[model samples]
Target: MSLTKITDKAGLHRHLEAAMQLEHATIPPYLNALYSIKPGTNTEAFHILRAVAVEEMLHLTLAGNILNAVGGTPDMTVPGFVPLYPAYLPDGETDFQVDCQAFSRAAIETFLKIERPAQGATPGVDTIHKGRKRAHHNGHKRHGTALRARHVPGNEEEHFYSIGEFYQAIEEGLERLHAEMGDALFSGDPARQIGPEYYYSAGGGLMAVTDLASAKAAIRLISEQGEGVTDNIFDYEGEIAHYYRFEQLLLGRYYQKGDARGRPTGREVAVDWDAVFPIKANARIADFPEGSALRQGAEEFNRAYGDFLSLLTRAFQGEPALFVEAVGGMFQLKELYYQIMRQPLGDGTHAAPTYEIPHG
Candidate 1:
């Protein structure tokens, strides 16, 4: 597939929304595995998954800041924004599948694919075009004269093979638009930006973007942390990226500095697969019987997830302080997920968070 060249502010904003959605997409599956681990067991794997999930949240905030820096509104509460489980990453890109499940070989493998590095030539193009007409999917029509790009199969000029490529295209767009629009490109209100004070407990602190340089740094942080720098598995912060961490679990060894690619020579790490609660893969609220404890627990978990999104939406809307409340919401989600895990489904399986938005 070909890359979609972004030329104007509108296209850049659309891609930023896509970026936000892509980052948000990784959290549910990660949380699914993280919460599924039995308490006091698989401690190392639990920490690893939790750390990665937190970084994904940071990536989401950075994408929102990038959108706001470019004078675009960040909306996370929109319908269909919170994807159904086993959904494709980045919404329109269907090259991979992500499933919500307990911590198992299959779940870790899915996480590995989600953070895999870009392999070939920056997956997309850098050419800019004006008035290019592209076909829309699902019988939907493009409402304006702005250039529309889709990532359907066989469309070489409108698809990206990996998340890194998608961000690279956004970076290129930012550069071009900054050259054209200069200071006006970062004209969004500074009050709307969420800074480090509001976000904590992550590997990297929040980056508030006000110009092209800061914006580029935020994008670099997200990309390198996930895909790594060039071919290396370590990010600039000297931490192993998500893919290598998951690989370490699979190889039964940790990745130490100066280790060769695909061969981790560090100390051994233990993963107790039996320690995970047997939560059904991609469990939904409807899967449980009505008025049952499992169903009620699943419903409550979904409600908390929805409230978290609501707070996040408000944070992106204008109230940056709402991020703190949203962080608290995240804590509530952890408790709720564990509560569900403690309740057995009576078939040798345990309850798990459905991750569906309540009333959505």
Candidate 2:
């Protein structure tokens, strides 16, 4: 049982940067399923997806805060920042391909996989380890170029079994670095931290990370809100974990207090699986012909999404105040999404936002 190690500052930077990217990776797919829901339908599913997406944004901000706490710069503008469609999450699973598809049972299943809880490992001690043997379920093709991000940069194949484990490794590394470097490890600029005032999300609230304690808290909150809350169906904040929230849509019932695992005894949750737009799975801009309305809509979406990322870059770098404008920018994307959604692709499926951040 050899474990991956983050032995230096540069390695920590890579891991945190990957953490930010991992958090951001879940957003587009979730949004794809979220916005894909038809008007006046799938109300329960919509709120679940929307809340989880917003929490992912909070998680991203917390990751950036931890990165900045360790004197590392947060850059969302880099190439490979926005992964290709059907991108693999950093959860170390090779079986599931997170796709940009419309709302359906398949999408909910993928969401469940993305937020699946870990079993058998304690948080700080035995969480991070080598990757698992590859599985052949789900019929998802492996993308050779986009390997699972490992703690050791050169060894991209090794990865944590769960995203919580990934962050746990980062937390452990922070403890080690803090012991070695003491105050020097927390030398990052304080001005770069995004405090609670700038972020308000359902799962959790944001906190500024200034030292090892705050840094560890930021990392732990992300895991708990995502998968670390597996010990209980609901987290300390009394909100259901993202995994169970999505599970409600599948089980056709909401989880109630005192409900056992895998069984929710609450009121029924109605899922209109047939009410989605049937957006093309894993859509790319190249799929649409040039000069077509769908093509222009997809291209315009990419440009607007690029500008949103730029706003996020500035907010993460030092201008935390810009997050308000960035939130506004996020809502603005919904219009572009609707524009593409309204344009039929003629294949009985409508266009979806490809999230292909334009490269400059």
Candidate 3:
């Protein structure tokens, strides 16, 4: 795909808007899938997914930073953030599906679509591949050679590449988004740049940091913010809220008017905690009499997840600075949860697979 550059405000606006929203969109499912995994065993996949997920958080902040730099107000919590599986994308070039079906297969498909979207896939348009190299085999495409080949996964049905592929695609899309709209892309109200009220760090500040250098510094700060320093949406303001994206999958219920900041006795009142994941209680592997491998995996995940939560609570109870470490630890919970959820439903007889998001 041909790369589009942000030449005017409008172009900047559109690309960043789409980029920011999409970045936020990624965090929800990633959080759910990552958190649902049983902790610590599916080690390799865990690390990979965690890295991508965190970086995607970084991507969200980076997109927000860009919006700020361009005088755009970045809204973190917004509607349309939570999405369904095999989700549809606008301006999507390929037939590939983007979903919350959190698994290696889903992960791979997600990475592929985000990295190498079907935008600008015109004939004879050979773009150079510039990224870390892995062993290459398949199709007429040469190894180490970059071309806009159709990015179909090993599983033929999911036609996306990988996260890195999507990253590259975003770079290309930056240009396309710009060319298509020009100044209109970046032309949002500069007044929207986050101020003290909108910007919050667990213990400190995320006030508007204008200019590139300050922007990078602020990005580093918020990307590291989690739990103690500032509770994540998972444990917002000292509350255990939501059982899956504000209730889409959790009894189809929702929580509104969550308690305000510093009210930290229970889950943020804003999150709907009453909603339930039907399988969450009974689904624990330890709950089953048979004590199958799946049960063991589920139990192990629960233990680690509990520890992870404890760390966050303590981090907040003591020094918010503890949040940084909590970030990494909480990440482990996500990895573990994924492993736990991977147990196929009755030998793949399950209908409509789901990412084990414990939010509502």
Candidate 4:
């Protein structure tokens, strides 16, 4: 539980990589649930999940921009970047389980937990508390914090327990580095920045980062849209944060401008749980029988998912225009996933996309 004290550029780069992974981790599970809903039914839930998933992509792009601004390459094609099913989220941190499954109450609860704010935790203002002291891998003894090497795998001891804390650490590190290096800290190519033209429907527009202020603004947008500011339910863009959106489904009600927290007094919302296709929880590619049509379709969906990731990696690498292609890939995935959901498995259930990366 010792906080990883990021002190240099290499440390920041590694943490940003973790950030990118963290953002990408939420998409598959969210997509699994979103695609499971019956078309024309649960429209509210569908829109909510779809919006959040798209914003998660925005968060990923923002993290990549930060890395690029610091002269670090954002490599999404790395091995283990696309985690296996029932994956632990916010990689290198807590053991919050996320799974690929159809839409259900359990799925919504999982989404709520993923987007929930860090309870009683203040970002950028509190000293990260360490649960225990441990020796650094380099045989150096540090007090009150842990020092870990950048980009080294299996270094779970160096991560923050919550996404907010992780970004807070990055913010602190950026401030320190900017003070030390000034304009040199943002030494990456300006042409590599991805702007609003490359991304749309991500709630707030994507901002390209060329300096410390822009970088901080991008990070803040990510945090606020996911967890909200302090205890408020709305982000700066007047949109409800992901946590509150899930809460609405749980409460079966929506929130208005004057509604109190925990008591959404807006319009009533209905969720038709029975309308969802009964996609098995944590469904895998192996679950479908071999040589079956379901298996073939699921495998094809996984391959497309892998292709989408490759395109996203290229977009982050240098070609921002590739984002349009990646977005189109997402639509193609939706079609495949829905087609799979429509197929029957000879049981009381239907086929569901396994969400595995075939080429990962």
Model 1 spans with C-alpha error above 4 angstroms: 1-3, 121-157
Q: What number of clashing residue pairs does each candidate have, in the order they appear?
A: 2, 0, 57, 0
Residue pairs with colliding backbones in model 2 are none
TM-score of each: 0.88, 0.90, 0.39, 0.88
Task: Output the better candidate (1/3) by TM-score.
Answer: 1
Per-residue lDDT of 308 in model 2: 90
lDDT scores for all predictions? Answer: 0.78, 0.79, 0.40, 0.77
Model 3 per-residue lDDT tens digits across residues 1-360: 111233445434444555554554555445554444445444444444455465555555455655655555453222333333344332122334454543333344454344331223312333333322221322222211111223323312211222223333434444465567554444434443434443233234544444444444444343333211222333333332221122212222222345332233333322222121212311323234365766556566645644544444343233335446656775575565556554555643111223222322
- Per-residue lDDT of model 2, residues 206-277, tens digit only: 899898888887887898888773557787777788888888999999999899877999999988899888
> Which prediction has more favorable lDDT, 1 or 4?
1
Provide the global lDDT of candidate 3 against the true structure: 0.40
As a whole number from 0 to 100, the lDDT of residue 200 in candidate 1 is 79
Give the 10-residue window scoring lowest on summed lDDT in candidate 4: 140-149
Query: Which of 2 and 4 is ahead in TM-score?
Result: 2
Write candidate 4's Cα lDDT for 1-360 as tens digits. Answer: 133457778878877877887898788788888888888999998898888988898899999999999999988766567667676554334434677778888888888767767646433433333423232343432221111233334333554545666787788899999999998999998888889888776677798999999999988988888875366787656888888898999899999886777799999988898888887777777878999878988999878887888888888888989989988888888899889888877777787777566542
Please state the error at residue 166 of candidate 4 in Å: 1.9
The TM-score, computed over Cα atoms with residue i paired to residue i, of candidate 3 is 0.39
